[model samples]
Target: MNRTLIITGKGKVSATPDIVYIRFPILVNDVHYATAVKGLDGIVASLRNCITTNGINKNELKTSDFRVNTQTKWNDNTKEYEFSKFEAHHDLLLQLPFDTELINNTTNDIVKLERNIEFQISFGVKDSTIYKQLLIENAISDAKKSAAIIAHASDIKLKEILNINYSFSEITFRSDLNYSYDSCLMETNEKIMPDLNPDAIDVNESITITWRIEN
Candidate 1:
């Protein structure tokens, strides 16, 4: 007969976020396709100008979503559906360092380019590849420690590990509150700033390890 000891171990590490992301969509609607495209081009150019003038890197800017669609709508006067109007959308995402002063100034400048443009801001870490490796090491260590403790109590020796499985939990780097460009511009005297401070994000890892047990 074969015998084995199975145990699951959990490890966690917390770190502060180092970067922030701002996402906005530029929507244009016009009766003619040419007009809609032209409007989109102008808004996109203005967006690029604002980002460049604020010292934000061009590589950090990304176009996430872009689409041009034509649809039909009811026309009471014509007594028939019309498909002359065109709608275009350009979604832009901006990444920048986590600086209160810089973010405030950049956002103010961006709003000046277009007041009606709606934007949302979120915070997160720039890269977690190294941190993930560290967490895996910690989790393996924890699994070994647990197996050793069990083996000692049973007066048995733990052999080579038969199987190992590890998974990471979902992490939240931003708070529940949403940042709005129009809302921030509403405040006259006070320079409105979003709640940029986010609590430490926990990097949680779990390992399910199986090892052979011997007498």
Candidate 2:
């Protein structure tokens, strides 16, 4: 009978993000759908112009999501929900390199456009191909090393790998500072700057290897 040795390995890789993503919300409300959409268009045009002045191409502004919904409100006389208006939202985004000067300049320009406007900033890597490759390599190496050690201790020989499986854990990144409109509108006397440091983003992966051993 052939015996098998199964070993699992864990790998973690860390890297600083090379890119920045900012999400801007453009909201409009009106009694008619067409009017609501028209209001959104006006805001979109203004946002495009704002980013273009900061050396960003107008095309770089992407629409993450756009949708219209009917809202309701309560009336004092009826004491029941009534139709409020149509609300349209355009979630716009911008991708920029991790440059301090560019970030400072671009965000400053965006804040001046409107006081109630809300935005979010997140740091991320441009390409995760290299990190993924490295993670797999490390996992494989770790499995081999562990299997070899166990086999040697047991006085057994490992001949061939019979199976290899990788877990489905997704790779994701997190941001340190996420700005909202209300918090951003604080008095200028008490100022807070967003963290510029590109914190280390960790990529973790695991693999299991089964090796056939001499009986």
Candidate 3:
């Protein structure tokens, strides 16, 4: 006669993000192409100055993108194409230690200079070693609990762990609120909370283990 048992377990763990990455896009528009470009350049200069003057590390600032485009309009009365406007867009990327207060302060200053700016912030684990260690410990604990439960149900005693299988879990990156015109307007000048909520992020891992049983 042969006896077999199967069990499943789940492990959950949460961590606060240590690092933040943000991308800001500033858009400048005017009827004149050169004027729009100049405005965008000035805004960029102001951003750099603000960062440097505020004591941000120089290495943390980087130019992610720059572009200029022209829009045209057709006149209904005169069957002619009219130069509508020109737009200059610049994207700036920044990396820093997670500090909500500092970020909020910096954003308030930036928005005062330019109204047509949008931002996206990403949070993640800075050290791979810490993440791996936490995940492995949680997985093992979950496996042990599952093995114990199975052993008790089958009227047996768990003798030893035969095998362990682990797969890397994906790191979830998301924002508290979706970015929209109305949301962005409300965020300006609003005091950002100093401590971010861990519930805003979800971190999980799974482990499969085989244990020997004695009956």
* Best of the candidates, TM-score: 2
Which portions of model 1 show Cα errors greater than 4 Å? 74-84, 167-178, 182-190
Q: Report the lDDT tens digits of candidate 1 across residue range 44-124.
A: 787777778878776677999999999788899989998967889889898888898888987777666543556888777
TM-score ranking from best candidate downward: 2, 1, 3
Pairs that collide in candidate 2 are none
lDDT of 3 by residue, 1-215 (tens): 33444454566666656777777777888998889988887877777776766578756778899899888899998999988898788888887776777766666666555444566766765665665677678777877887787788878987666667777756454434322223365555654334444344445677787776679
Cα lDDT of model 2 overall? 0.81
- Indicate the TM-score of model 2: 0.87
What ranking emerges by lDDT with the best candidate at the front? 2, 1, 3
- Which residue pairs in candidate 1 collide? none
Q: CA shift at 153, candidate 2, in angstroms?
A: 2.4
Return the lDDT, model 1, position 51.
77
Better of 1 and 3 by lDDT: 1
- Quote each prediction's TM-score: 0.81, 0.87, 0.64
lDDT of 2 by residue, 38-145 (tens): 989988888788889988899999999999999999999999999999999999988998887887777766666653456778888888778888888998898899
lDDT of all predictions, in order shown? 0.77, 0.81, 0.68
